[model samples]
Target: MPMLYLNTRHTLPMIGLRVQHNTVDTPITQPRYEQETQQARAGRGFTQPKITIDSYPSRHSYGYTNNTDFARENLERGMSEVQKGTSKHTQMAWALAEDGPKAGRQVGIEFAKRDMEQRVTRQRTLVAAAIPDPVIQVDPGQTHGAPIPAKTTPIWHTEGKAQITYHRGSFETYLQQKGDIHSWTSEGKYDIYA
Candidate 1:
């Protein structure tokens, strides 16, 4: 099971400038670990194994900004304020769509509604399916960076069909493989905000 811990903070001026915090613990039926076991058994495991990579690229063009000079100035200033780092937008979009196709469609619709160019072009984010058996070995000592089994040619197979159903305030993801089910609750402020 996957454990989620959340803490909410609010100011309490009535009690001599004190702070109040509420903690919520929600246990979730963990995502399947079949991939982890397969990677280990296949000897493709590494000190750091990247199981999933989710990304959301916001391709919306900001609406008109007064005039060209004003836009140019803002662009320069914005570029200066930006720093090189892993962005949270990617994970956020994935989280919104991870619930399933209905939720995923909502994500694209929301993004499309925001961009004025929706008629000409639509900006959307997609969540990638679980990776196949191709695992990367990061240990320098392991096989000198060559993929295990040495593929002669590329082979492809479906990752299986996935469907999510919502009941009450919880959702269950059903996989085609042996009808495996993963459940999650839609509780807490994070759920509301998302």
Candidate 2:
């Protein structure tokens, strides 16, 4: 039996392979508006009706799977040359040619999976720092007669965002604002009542 002794220390340097990375993002949730209403007193008030505003915070999330086909192909191609007696390490290439591709592919997959996870975590941190909390503004305007039960609906316009970063790149962010008033009736002295 002829034993093959493969030395990777020199073969790898000669290959000079470059790593490639790609990212794809998909929105898991659709954008929509929701409202919740509550009743509160205008508070022993003078004239105008007052409103208390509450807003929901923006949210972010991500998911991914690692496919190392690219890494597998590159590694196999590079190692095959050695297996074909093209390199000094051909003697050792026999064993590696059998198991090297599988091991290399698994390593590549694990590395890519971990890398993607870290990227997602970092992106989430960046998004949290970038997006500001939602703001709700209400102008009670004027009221009349007596203080009536006011119906106030806190409105929130929420949407999912998918940010894809290629080779550790940056993403764009912006603020969204929404406002609305529903079902108000006026009788006498009190200015506004819901």
Question: What's the true lDDT of residue 22 in model 2?
Answer: 53
lDDT of 2 at 153: 75
Model 2 has how many clashing residue pairs?
16
> Per-residue lDDT for 1-194 in model 1, tens only?
45453534333333122233444444454454322122222444444433442221111123333466578888887776563212435544674767436632666556556545655676577765543443334433323243445234334444354444443443334432342333334433333332
Q: For each candidate, what TM-score against the reference?
A: 0.15, 0.17
Best by lDDT: 2
Can you write out model 2's per-residue Cα lDDT over 1-194, one digit (the tens) per residue? 44443322211212233444455555356556666766766655345556655433333212221246456766898799666545434534653566557744554445457658876888443443454454667676663556557686766666645655445445444333333334333344333322
Candidate 1 residue spans exceeding 4 A from truth:
1-88, 95-97, 117-194
Clashes of each: 0, 16
lDDT of 2: 0.50
Best by TM-score: 2
**Decoy 1 TM-score against native:** 0.15
Q: Model 2 RMSD to the real structure?
A: 66.4
